[model samples]
Target: MYVFGDSLVDNGNNNFLRSIAKSNYYPYGIDSNRGTATGKFSNGDTFVDYLGAWLGLPAPPPFADPTTTGPRILGGVNYASAAAGILDETGQHYGERYSLSQQVINFETTLSQLRTMMSGPNLSRYLSKAIAVVVLGSNDYINNYLLPGLYPTSFNYNPTQFANLLLNHYARQLVALYSVGLRKFVLAGLGPLGCIPNQRATGQGPPGRCVDYVNQILGPFNQGLLSLVDALNNGSHPGSIFVYGNSYAAMGDILNNPARYGFRVVDRGCCGFGQQITCLPWMPPCFDRTQYVFWDAFHPTQAVDAVLAHRAYAGPPSDCHPINVQQLALINFL
Candidate 1:
């Protein structure tokens, strides 16, 4: 898989850059097989990691990693970066990050390297079978438009207009990926941003309740994205299959019925104080991590990641629209 988007899917790509949005530290990978952090922002693996294993492929290496050269390219490369967004200026506060456009440019570099090993039909066939997983846009709201003090987006455009701006740019970027030979895509929509610990702790809602205003703003973007999926598949790109992963509904199910998913803590994270800040380095996380929905103020725990991955992999239409990842994998449009 060729992964894109923000920290939700980022697995060490930000570590290589001079960015504060990094998680290559203690207590981060406390549940991994090695119990050593490899820059994934969770107690164990991200959903993308689980999805990779489900597909029988090794976790794609970070594109910026020094070892991501030669034969390693065959396993795919992860270009996801923490704090990244659809807009170029979205995460400037965090220093360096690969925006969607920059990630595609980096993919072009990867494609150039692949051409050295395979050309024409071989390269096209290889790319056609690969899945391009894009889970972006949250940062555009969390890091950019919402930060009215740092950005003028809120002053310029309303929520609906901002979402449209994001979708317009995103559509162009996806088409760019298609032009480069990617035939399969998993376009995950934005989730309930208001329900996260950071937003909940802002004192914008009733005690222990989600910030409904924040969640309401994301509806237009998610609905428009589902429409974009239909737009792309209906002959916009021949043989291309773009599936919409409904992250909003998938996460909402877990939040609404935490007990059903074996989660005890729904309003806070297992590590930090469940405030605005993230978990500190070497901080001791909860021993019963499986009982918590969030790992940090913003990211979900490995347990939650596992559930979301399972849903996207084979769940019904409520989780993955049109077709699940398993169905996408079975298709050979080439």
Candidate 2:
């Protein structure tokens, strides 16, 4: 399987980049990787790591690794980067980051290498069976469109129009990926962006509550994504399997039922900073991560991520549409 998108699936890719959106520091990854951070936004494992383990596969290595050669490529790669988004300008404030367009290009290189390493039939079988996970768009909303001064995308389009624009562009990118022979795709929806600690810190709404207006924008986009999935599976792409991971609903469940989900904190992040800040070099992480829903101002803690991924991978119909990832993987598309 291959993982793509932003900090939610980053797994240390940004450590190699000259970007500020990195987690290779203390108090991050203290639970996983033996107390040394590995560049995931979470304090422990990420969505991809949990999903990979559930699928009986090792977590894919970062694509940026110099040693990602030969059979290592067979397990696939993680092209996700901290602060990356579908739109190039989404994370412009963070300097260099892999836009979705760039991630596709990297996958193209991987396809090229696979062709070199295997027979044609084997390559086709490999692509048709492998799963590609995409978790993006939150940064496109939180970091760009709503940044107020850094970008003008929000000004040019209303929420409905913006959702259409993103869906249209995203469709083209997904088709470009399909062109290279990928069959199974996991399209993750954006979570409730307004409720995350960083967005709360933005002061766009009343303190200690979710910013409903910002979160409202995510629904139209997620609906469009679901429609896209249905279209892809309804004979548009023969043998294609696409499943929607409802991250929004998952996050809602966590926030509304934290203690039920075994989490103690739902509103604030585990890492320390001022009311609006998070995980600064001066700030240290809380001692107990299992209690917190978020690890930083923007990302979920690993403990929370595991629950989300488990549900998306094998939860009921509400967590993953059409069929969950477990069912999606079991089918023989060929």
Candidate 3:
């Protein structure tokens, strides 16, 4: 599988860049198998890592990692970067990031490398079996639309218009991937960012309450994304399958019933000071990490990732529309 998107799935692509949104330090991977920070934004593996494990593949090396070449490419590559978004300028303030379009370009580069190792038909066959997991759009809101002082997106487009704009850009980018030979896709919709520690830090409402205003604006994008999935599944791209991973519902389930998921702290992050959101390098994280829903200001703990990965892999249509990742994997092409 080829992974794309922002910090939610970023394994370490930002480590090679000049981006400030990095996690290559202590406490970031305290719970990972390596027990060393690998630039994952959580206390351990992200949902992408769990999904890869279920798929029987090792964690794909970051695409930007110089060591990620040759046989390593066969396991797939993760092009996810911290603070990346659907638009080119979405996270420009962060210094460097591979936006959705840039990630696709990198995939094209990977395809070029694969061609040298196999016949055209064999290459096509190999790509046809690969899954493209795209989890983007969160940064577009967190780093772009919401930051009116830095970006003009909010002033230029209302919530509905901004969503349409993002959808249009997203559709074109997905079509570009389809043209490149990726036959299967898992498009994860945005989760409720309103409840994240960063948004909560803003104190938009009553104490411990989520910023409903932030989540309200996100509805149109998630809804349009579902429609986009339907259109892509029924569109002109033969053999191309698009599945929408309803991250909103999957995450909502955990937040609304934290105890059901074995979580205690559902309102704040395990690391970082109040209102600071992102962890300062080397800061000590929570001792009981498994009981926390969030690992940092914006990302979830490895525990939450496990739940999300499970839902997307085998949950009902309400979690992953049309088919789950397991079913999508079973789909064969003649």
Candidate 4:
């Protein structure tokens, strides 16, 4: 399995980049087993790490990291970069970052090198069997379309128009990966962005209540994304298997009914205070990471990531439409 997207899945790719969207610092991975930060945005593992382990594969190395060079690429290389979005200029505020277009281009280069390193038949088998997993659209909506002054997308187009634009571009990105020989895909929906500590604090929607407007704004994108996945699965590629992961619903379930998922604090973050500025190098985190849904302002705790990953792997119909990740991986697609 290969992974791509923003800080949610970025293991360490942004660490090498000149981008300010880096998480390779103290307290970020305060509980990632070894207790040392590894560029993961959360207090422990990212959702991808848990998903990879559940699939019986060690988490793939970041595509750009020095340690990922040579033969290690075969296990699959993660091209995810923190602050990445569907469009090239989406995260310009961060200075330097990989857009979805660039990540695909990087994947193409990796595939080209793989073809050289392996026999043609072996490479073919590898490419055809691999699952191209992507988690996107959130940064596009939050960083590009919502930042009215910094980005023209939101000002130029309203919510619906902006969603259509994002979906159209997203379709092209998926097709690009299809052309590169990936047959199975896991397209994750953006989670409850407005409910996150960062959004809640910035939007200021009364104490303990989520920012309804922000969450409402993202509804169109999720709905459109579901439809887009269905269209793509309908022979956009002859043997393609595309699974839509309902991230909004998955995270919402936990937020709405925290105890049901073994969580206690769904509103606040476990690390630092539940504010956008919390969880820096100087701040100390809460004692129990398992109780809170969020690790910091933007990312989920390892506990929440584990829950979300398990659901995506073998979840009910509401969380993963058509099928789940494990089911998608089992498909022959030939």
Estimate, for each residue in 1-334, the C-alpha lDDT of model 4 and write its tens digit: 7888988899999989998888777788888788888888888898989998888888999988877766888889899988889988988898788889999998987888798898987777778789888988888977887788888886788888888888899899899898878888899998988898888887558778888888887888889999998898787578788889999998998899999878898777776677674477746788888889988888888888898899999998798988998887787744
What would the C-alpha RMSD of candidate 4 be, to one decimal place? 1.4
Q: Give stretches of model 1 more than 4 Å off.
A: none
lDDT of each: 0.92, 0.86, 0.92, 0.85
Residue 41 local lDDT, model 4: 87
Residue 74 lDDT in candidate 4: 86
* Candidate 2 per-residue C-alpha lDDT over 1-334 given as tens digits, one digit per residue, 9 for 90 to 100: 9988998899878888889888888777778867777777767899889999899999898988788878998998999988888987789899789989999999999989999999999999989999999998988897888877988988998888988988887888899888889999999998998898877887778978888888998889999999988898899888788899889998898898888988887678888662355577636788777888888878888888889889988898889989999998898877
Give Cα distance to truth, residue 276, candidate 1, Å: 1.7
Q: Runs in model 4 with CA error above 4 Å?
A: none
lDDT of 3 by residue, 142-186 (tens): 999999999999999999999999999999999999898899999
For model 4, give the 10-residue run with minimal summed lDDT: 270-279
For each candidate in turn, the TM-score is 0.99, 0.97, 0.99, 0.96
lDDT of 3 at 272: 88
Q: Which ten residues in a row have the lowest lDDT in candidate 2?
A: 273-282
TM-score of 1: 0.99
Backbone clashes counted, model 1: 0
Candidate 3 segments exceeding 4 Å error: none
